[model samples]
Target: MKLIVNAIPFAGLETGITRYVRCLYQALGAELGVQVGYLGYHGLQPTMPQAADPDLWSRQTKRFWGLPQPLIAAINATQRLRLERLLRAGCRSVQPRIYHETDLIPPPRLPLPRVYTIHDLSLVNHRHLHPKERLWLFDLFFERRIRQVDHVITVSEFVRREIIRDLGLEPRRVTAIHEAPSARFFPRPAAEVGAMRRRMELPEDYILFVGTQEPRKNLPLLIRALALVKQPTALVLAGWSGWGDQAWRQLLEPLRLEQRVYTTGYVDEETLADLYSGARVTVYPSLYEGFGLPVLEAMACGSPVIAARAASLPEVAGDAAWLVDPQDPRDLAEALQGLLADPERRRDFAEAGKKRAARFSWQRCARETLRVFERVAARKQARRS
Candidate 1:
């Protein structure tokens, strides 16, 4: 079967969705006796498995979503139209057994069996957390065309339910395939963890939060919670910048967490694994998530995790993690302080987390996803027959 994934996300920024598309495709491409192709570049030329990582993408992704006010909206419109035309033209020529879009937007009027991955309803349901440009684009392109998608893949059952509720799609049209921690995230040897921590110049003991600095992450609440914790540990954040730099500054300034908080910009996968393995406890206080990859990553690294109980987080974390209310800073602080006060409890959670993380794998995600594509392809074939 010729399975072509619209891997254009890998050709752009190294965001969570990009990582999702790349990792799933990498696993799928490795299968024998199947011709797996990628549409990473504008030409829709077959994607190289080696180029799945965004580091290898030739062009530095132009950050347009969060820009200064003076830039003309016309330029953004022009760019969107041009990209749509180029992608549509390039993709239409490569007729495959099935075409899968990793992101929300589907290809324009391509008469092929198509599958779309819906990460979350955050854009559709919680538009206030995002910028106007993003909301505008999604409203224009994604909302209408998404219904035309032949099938849908969601990261969690919560998202699958949300899709049925929000999109009014038939339940059978969507499948929930759990995303996994990458191969790089796992229990690292103590020596290697120490060496990497030293190389990164990280504090010996600190709370860890792995996510972009954004409003959706509820970082300000976490920051306030950290301030209230009487424990002597620092807070280490490992992620790229999103849209809340000013908000972050205001929160940190008033709290005066200059000595207690450390914010490291985008670290490589190896470093991220090390940071996860090194933390006293990893925290994920996001208000919502489609799947909450970092929570699983921390678990895979054998790190004790404390995540929010909202949305898909509890679904992902399951019984293995300490769940906290994301909205209440007081509740988050109590949980952090309580966990830190008991090392024995942290150790117990660590062991449980590792066991839980073992249940999910990229290979499994690929297999399930491939099954969905093949199911639809067979239907399309039977219709023609």
Candidate 2:
């Protein structure tokens, strides 16, 4: 019943992986009490049950110990030997039945059952969208390391299919466990939403897009679509400015959407809830996704969504969102125009979205994940018996 999750990713940036690890661990820890622990850069920390709020744990740790991505990679490379030693020490102390690898790095070769969660095959699928350094590490370790795991987990069925086809993993060996939005994202009161809007200097009614501004997010297509939309409603770009900002900016330049587009760089989850609640319609036209989190998050917050019919988005959005071709600006623009004009449709979608989002919860995700771990561990034990 004892489990140790490699939490070294928490020492790095607060990406989607970090959220997944934190949330899953919190729920698992709550369920299992002291039976679960986390293996960080230092060693083993059997302090799971103590984490009342996963976000609190992340805030305390990330601020105190977070490192830049490149530096974290360099440190991980240099500390592999040390890491193995720590792993051995942890194994001896905790005697864990399972080791969960949250990040893509291969689990240290050990007797314990291994569970590796592959968020996406973006590196393999879209090399141009990723950095050279990342691709280099991926090429060196991903294929070799992936084979060492006892079981694989993916965030979505689309990714599960990709892993099965590309890596040739057995279908039963890989499971797709969907992620859920934090409890923080829900319908905020109109008064609170108005306050947040004023604080961020956002328009009263705006279309919201939440994600890092990267090429893979398909920001250019969204920007082009925004220009094409005749509605005077503004577009709020809420997230960190990832790479490829120039290309998106170039597309935005000629459109003269400087006044129409509001860039609120990197808001917190609380702010995000307000943004989502206040939004007329939330648009996510990403080219690909392992799981389109914002689509669900917005849905949870009572925002009708229009997501791209690409990758796992349609699966995540289901019939709750207005699915449009990511490549076609006209399609996106028309969806926007239609959604903006129809209040009743928006209300219906909002209710349906809430109902759909209610189907997912971190507790559910944790329980299903635990079932996977139990099966893997029991299989290993059976082999020994």
Candidate 3:
């Protein structure tokens, strides 16, 4: 079946959504060949800004938000208009059987069946957690625009339920297609892991937390919990800094954990795999997530995971990782201590996690997603008849 997708996300930084689109299309292309088409701006793949240097991180944050609010809004409007024009022209040429909106923003009304992928309703559900501009955009456009689509696809069942309950979408109109860790995330050899650890200047034994350092990630709680752990293990924050208050650093000084924590800026997937393989245990105590990918990634890389028992994390981690209350530092600390103290338990968890991670694959996601597209297209054709 012929398909067209919104390529707007490719114009920005490499985020979870960007990765989702890239992986899904790669798998889809392998099966469908030239049936897939992309519309909108396609710039050079955006790289994550390195944050190993504090000053560089600060400058990048300032450069992003330094623009006047009114100017930023105008730019956003112009970009959207250009994207819509591109979509209109591309649709005429490609004559696609289905249109998939990978980004939340909907395209102009199209004759063909349209499917939208809503990663989460965080802007509506957790407004306090997002930036002001994001809230304004969601309030003004997203809720209304989302209703115009024929079908909604979510990254997790929890998010699907949220979209159904909160947005009042019909259960039959929405589907949940789980995402998978890339093939690159696998058990790395000990020698490679050792060399990577040395090259990155990471501690001999460290607890790994992979993701952008933002308030939503609950890094402060992880830092506090680290202080409480009995072992003198180091904590490594592997991803770059995202937009949010840098309160996690403030806590480190007061808690006397300044030296115990290390930030590796942003590393590539290969380095991430090695880091995960070398980690004593990977922890992702985020406040909420539509789908907790790092938990699966860590498990796939032969590391035991400890994730929050909130939102979709339990669903993602399944029975493999230790689930803990995200808000309670003491509870998370106890779990960390218990897990670190037990070698046999960690090994068992690693095996169980690998098995759990294996159940999800990009090929499977593409197939399931394709079924939705076909169903939507068939129904449209039936209605036309």
Query: Per-model C-alpha lDDT, please?
Result: 0.81, 0.84, 0.84
lDDT of 1 by residue, 1-385 (tens): 7766766665555658878977887787776345666664355556543434444332232355435533534565566566556556655665678878776565556667888888999998898888676666566677678778889999999999999998999998999999988888888888988897788787789899988777899888888999899987999988766665457667777888878888887777888888898888999999889999999899999899999999999999989999999889999999899889999999999999998898999899989988998999999889989
Candidate 2 lDDT, 70-170, residue by residue in tens: 76556546666576678878888878999888875667688799999989888888899875545665676677778788999999999999999998999
Ranking by TM-score: 3, 1, 2
Report the candidate with higher lDDT, 1 versus 3: 3
**Number of clashing residue pairs in every model?**
0, 0, 0
- What RMSD does model 1 have? 2.6
* Native-to-model Cα distance after best TM-score fit, residue 45 in candidate 1, in Å: 2.8
Q: Tell me the tens digit of each residue's lDDT in model 3 across 263-350.
A: 9877778899999999989999999899988899999999999999999998888899999999999999998998899999899999
TM-score of 1: 0.92
Error of 1 at 205 (Å): 0.3
Instruction: Sum up the clashes in candidate 3.
Output: 0
Give the clashing pairs for model 2: none
